[model samples]
Target chain A: MTATTPAPSAPVAAPEPPVLAAVDVTKHFAVRSAVGARSVVRAVEGATLDLHRGRVVALVGESGSGKTTLARLLAGFYTPTSGEIALEGVPVRQRRGRVERSYHKDVQLIFQDPFGSLNPLHRVRHNLERPLKLHHGVRGKAELDRRVRELLERVALTPAEQYADKFPHELSGGQRQRVVIARALAVEPKVLLGDEPISMLDVSIRLEMLNLLDRLRTEDGLALLYITHDIASARYLCDDVVVMYAGEMVEGGPKEQVIADPQHPYTRLLVESSPDPGRGARDRDALFDADADGLGEPPSLIDPPPGCRFHPRCPFAMDVCRTQAPPRADLGDGRWARCWLHAADRTITQENE
Target chain B: MVTQFVPDTDRPDAGTTSARRADGDVLHVTGLTVEYVTDGDPVRACADVTFTLRRGEILGVAGESGSGKSTLITALTRLQRPPAVTTGGSIVFYPRDGGPAIDLVTATPKALRALRWTSLSIVLQSAMDALNPVMRLGAQFADALRTHDRTLTKDAAWARAAELLATVGISGDRARSYPHELSGGMRQRASIALALACGPELVVMDEPTTAVDVVMQRQILAQVLRLRRTLGFAVVFVTHDLSLLLELADRIAIMYAGRIVELGTARELYDDPRHPYTRGLRDSFPPLHAPLTRLTGIPGTPPDLRRPPSGCPFHPRCPQRFAGCDTDLPELVTKGGHSVACRLHEPTGRPDPVPDPASGPASGPASARTEGGAS
Candidate 1:
C-alpha cells in the first residue's frame, strides 16, 4: 500500500530544495526537580520539518508541546542533541566567528513580544540601521537611512520618517511589532521564523499582521515558519499544518485536509476544541461530553509516558500503543500521521473516510 | 441630559422592585461607573455600564485589554483597590432565600463579609494568584469551606473539598498536591473547584480559561457548563476573546471605550449584530471550518479613554460612521430585546440609509466565504 501511494505531488523535474530544514532534530534541557533530583526535559524529540521558499508551514501545538523548541533549533539558537539542521541544502555547524553570523543574516527570528524585542533607548531608525550595518555592512548614513526607510515602508508603516524617529515607547503594540518586522527584513533574510508573532497584539489587529506576513512571503519569496496555538489563524495564513503533541510531531499535511479530516486523535481534539461559533449548542454539548471523558492534559516532558506519548489520554489506545511508539502511516497528497490505527496493514481509506 | 444623581439610600427597595419585575434576575447593576483617579483628570474605566445577569445564565463580558471589562468585574465584586473607585452605580444582589436585597456598593464591610463565600465567589485569570501557592489544593478548598460554615468539622470540610475537586475532573487523591505540583490546566480547574466549594449562587470568572491550552480550555468550559447546569449558579465570564464567549455565554455584552456598546443573546449577536463595533468584533475571529479568505480586521486601535473620541468613541474607526456619529453620543437603547448604542440604530438621530452588508469593506472577504458547516 505504501508503494502504491504516489510520491508527494510528484515534483516535476526535481523541485527546489527547502530554504531551511530540520532533520530528526531533538533538544533536551536538564533541570532540578523539587527534591533536587536531576531530570531531563525532552523538549523536542526527532522532529523533522522543511520550510520552502514562498511557503508557510504552521507549527500548531499547546503550550509545552515543544513547537517553540523546534523553531529555536532551526534558528541556530540551540545546538541539536542529535540530527541535523540544513540551510539551503547545506548542513549548519555550531561555530562563532563568521559562519554563525552569516547564518543569522540568512535566517532572522521574530520574537513574540514586540515591546521587548526592540532596544528601548534607540530610535526605530537606529534599530533598523544596526542590522543593515552589522549584517550587510552597508556604510554611509545616506545608504543606511534609505534602507531603513525602505524597510519601514515594506512593513506598511506609512510616512517612514515619522515612525523612523520615534522611540519604541512611542509606538503602539501593533506599530512596534511592525518595526520589529521591519528590522527583520533589514538583512533581507531568506527564512522568517515568527514565534507567536501576533499573539501579543490585539485581536482586531492580528489579522493585519498575518496579512503583512503573507505579503512578505509572496513578494519576497521568503519561507515562513508561523508558530501559533490558534488553529483558526493557522488555517487562515498557513498553506501546510503540523500538529505536535508532547514534544513529538503527530500529524502533518495540507492545511485543509488536516483541519477538515484529522487522522490522529490529538489533532482531531485540537481542531474540535478551537472555538467555532458557527457550531450549534447540541453539537457542542456532544463534543463536550466526549471530550470530558477522554481528554487529559499534555504529559510532563521530564518523565513522559512510555510508548505513544498520547496513549494515556487517547481513546483508541490499544495494547501495542501502550508498549511501543507507532510508525508513520503515509496518506497520499502529502498527508501522514503517526498512529497505530493507521498502520499499513490496517485499512486506512475506509476508516479515515 | 444631566439628571441629579441620587444615592443608593434614597431607593432602598429598588433592588426588590426590579427583581420582582424581572423575576429571574440574579444581579441588577444600574449606572455602573468605575473611575481611576489619577493626578490628572480622572479616567472613567467603566462608564454607565448597565446589565442584568439572569439566574443560572452565563453572561460574558467581551472587550479588549484596556476596554474596561476587567474593571467592571472588579467593581462588581467590590475588589477594586485604591485609585480605582466605583464613582456612581448600584450593584443590587437578590439573595436566593428571598431576603432583602443588599446593595453591594453601599453595604457595610461587615455586611459584605457576611455575603462573601456563601453568596458570591471569584476565579481570577492566573490560578496561581488565586490559589495558595504553598498550601495543598484540598487544604485551600477546606479553608474556604470551613471559613464560610463554622458548623462543619475539619474532616467534613476536607471530604467536601475532595468532592469539589472531583467535580472539576481532578482526582480525589490529587487534591493533596500543592498548586505548583499540578499542571496549568489542573491548577485552573482547582481554583474553579475552590470557588464553588461554598456552593455560591454566582461565580465571577475573569478569563479563567485564558491561561490554558485550547483543548484544556474546552474541558474547563464544559465542566463549568455541567456544574452550572447541576448546581444552578449564575456566571459572569469575562474574556477578550469574543469567539469563546459566543460558544460559552448565554448572553454577551460587547464593551468598548469603557462602555457597553452592545448587549444581546449570543445567537442574536452572532447572526445579526446591531452595533457596528459588535459586528467588527464578531468578524475579527477567523472561522475554523469555513473556506479561508482574506479578512480585513477593524482598521484602527481602540481609542485612548483619557481623551476618547468626541461623540461616539467607536466612530473614528467605524467604517459605517456618518455625519451624526461624531456629533451626538448614542445611548444604549433596547429594541426587540437587543440593545445597541450606535447612531445607525437610533431612529431619531439620522435617516441615513444603512450601508449595504455586501458593499462594506469588511463584508467582501467575509461574504465570499461559505458559512461553516456542521462538524
Candidate 2:
C-alpha cells in the first residue's frame, strides 16, 4: 500500500485508528478544610480526548491545567463526576468484572516518577513479576524469571539479567524511567498514558526516552497519550496536540496545526515565549518582554474568570468573556480552539461582557 | 567555621568602566589550568580553557552537569571553594574605575565582597537558597542595600527595595511577602532584583531557569532580558539546555569536559556547529517544529570527567572522529568568523562542510530556521 499524500489541511493518514476515548469527561474534587464544609475544585472540566493505535496524542498544559485529573479519569482511577470514558467503546466502571479486568489489562498508565511509583523495598524483578502474575496468572519461579527478563528487555534495559536484581535506588534516572515503561507494558496494554515521563529527566537523555516511546507507538501498535507542559516537546513527539488552559481544551488537533498556527492567545504566548538564542537573541528577548508584561498570574481555578478561565490574564480580553463561556469551535480543517478570536473573524470576544 | 574572601575596595569609581577597558577583551588568559584538590587525588576540573568576552558583551557557558561549566562561572565569580582550588590559571578582570586590573583567583575576601554585588553578582541555580527563608523580601532587599552602603537609612532602603521590585516587574506589595509566599517565578525574579539591588555591572547566572517549567522559564528569561536593557548589565548565562540557549544569549560557548569546544554568535553556533560534540548535542533535542522526526540520541554517556578521554574529551562519542583526534587536543581557532575547537574545521585535509544529519532529520537543527514573527 502506498503512503499518504493528503492536502495541506487534511488530516495525516494513520496506520491505525482510535483505541480509547474520553467523551466530554469531567472530574471534580471537594476541598474541605478543618472547620469548613466543602468547596468544589473542578480538577477536570469537560475534557474530551482520544488515544489512537500506533500514534501519539500530546496533552499540553502548564501546572494546574487539569492534566493529571484527566489522566486519572481515563485510567479508571477516578470515576468522572460527569461525562464518560470508554476503552474500545466500553464505559469504564469500578467492579472487577471479567470485561473490566481485561480492559484494565489492555490500557495501562505510565506515571512520571519511577522512584515514587515503584516500591522501594522490592527488587526490580519482583516489581515486574507481581503485575505479570496478578494480571496474566503466570506461575513457577523459572517462568516468572523468564517473563520478568522479557519485560525488561522489551524496554531496552538489555541483558535484563543485570537490571532484574537491582532495586529502584540503584538504577539511573533513564534506567528507572525504562523500568516504569516496562512495568506498564508487562500487562500488554494497547494504550499507554505517559504523564510527563520525560519532564523529570536530564536534558541530554530525555529525547532518547521519548524516541523509544515513539518507536513503541508506531512499531508495536501502541497508542500513547503524552501529557506535558512543554509545548515544544509535544509538537516534536506527538501526531496531534491539545492545549489545555484551566480545564478546557483551548486549542487542539494535529500537532503541526496547533504549534505552527496557534489560534488561542495563550497557545501563541507559550510558543513565542521560548528562548531560541540563535534567532537573534535580541529579537527573542524583546518578544519575551512584550509578552511577559501582559501575562498576569494564572487565575484561581476554583473561581475561574467567568467566560473563559484565561480571560483575567489574557492580553486581549473583552467584557463579554467574563460573563459567558465561549464554545469550542472549528479552527479550520480538523483542528478546534475555544477562544472568541477564532470565532467568525471575530474581534477578541470574552464571555463576561 | 567560615572563611573570609574580601580583597580590596579602596579604589574610587571612575565614571563608565566598559569604555576604558582598552576594548579587545578584559579577562584574558591563555592555557589556563584548574584542578579540584579532592581528599585522595586532585581532580583536573578545567584544562587550558581560553576565551574572551568583550567589555560589555554577554558570553553564555553551555554544558551539562559535571561539564565544568559551573566551575568556569564560579572561577570568574571568585567563589570556587574547598577541594576545588585553582591549580593554575589567571582570570584578569579589568576593573573599570581606573583601579588596578585584579586576578580573581587571588582577590581577598573583603575586596571580593566589594567587587561582588557592585561589580559582579552571581544568581545561582537554587532560588530558594539564594534568598533567606525567614526574612521578608523587603527586609532582605534592605539588608543588601545597607551592607553595600552604611549611609543608606531604613527609609531610603525600603524606598529603593520597592523601586527594584518594580524594575523586575514585581509590585510593591511583594516586598512584604516572604520568599515561600511568592511563586517560583516571583522568587527567582526577587532574587534577581536583589542581585541587581546593588547595581552590579556584570551578572553570572548558573542555570537560572533550570528548576522551573518552560513557561515560567521563558517569563524569567524575558525579565532578565528586560533588566539588561534597563540596567545595562552584561551577563554570563550558563545552562545545560542548548535548545534554550539558542534564543536568549548573544554569544554561546559550548563546553565539554573542561574547555570550550565551540564559541560564536548564537546563530553561528547553532546553525553551523563545527565540533562533533556540538553536533552530538544538537541531535539530543527534539526540534519544536517537526512532528515525526525520531531524535537520534548520542549512543554512549558523556565520559567520566576524572578519567577524561585522551586527545579530545568528545573523541569517545564522535561518529566522525579521525585517527589524529585520539591523541591530539584541538585548540579553539577562528574560521569563517566562528570559533571552533575541532581538527576538521582547520584549513587542512578535505573541506568537509556537510552538516551533521545525525543532529536532526533531513530538514533539522532548524536553528534560527524559524524567523518567528509572533508578536
Model 1 Cα shift for residue A169 (angstroms): 1.9
Show pairs that collide, candidate 1.
none
In candidate 1, which residue ranges exceed 4 Å CA deviation? A1-14, A280-284, A290-294, A346-353, B1-21, B356-375
Model 1 error, position B157 (Å): 1.2
Candidate 2 wrongly placed segments (more than 4 Å) = A1-17, A32-39, A95-104, A114-123, A165-171, A276-286, A289-291, A343-353, B1-40, B290-294, B334-337, B346-375
Q: Model 2 Cα displacement at B61 (Å)?
A: 1.9
In order, how many clashes per candidate?
Answer: 0, 28
lDDT of 1 by residue, B21-40 (tens): 34576777878899999999
Per-residue lDDT of model 1, residues A74-100, tens digit only: 888999988788998898986588999
Tell me, by DockQ, which candidate is best.
Answer: 1
| Candidate 2, TM-score of its B chain | 0.86
For candidate 2, lDDT tens digit of each residue in A1-353?
Answer: 11111213323334333588887777778898669978888777877776777777889887888988888777777889888777776767664678667877888888888779888999999889988898999999999999989888888888999999999998877788899999999898989998999877766678778878977976787988999987767766777788888787787876776787788988887777654332432566455664565476566677777887888878778876777677666654457778776765743323221
Residue-level lDDT tens digits of model 2 in B1-375: 111111112121222232224443445443456788866667777776666555456678888666788888777887878777776655666655657666666667876787889888889888999999999999999998999899999988998999999877899878898998888878888888899988777788988888775677877787788778777777889988887877767778888888888888777667667787777676676556543345566665666676788987888788878777788888777654577788777666324654445432333434431212222
* Residue B70 alpha-carbon offset, candidate 1, angstroms: 0.5
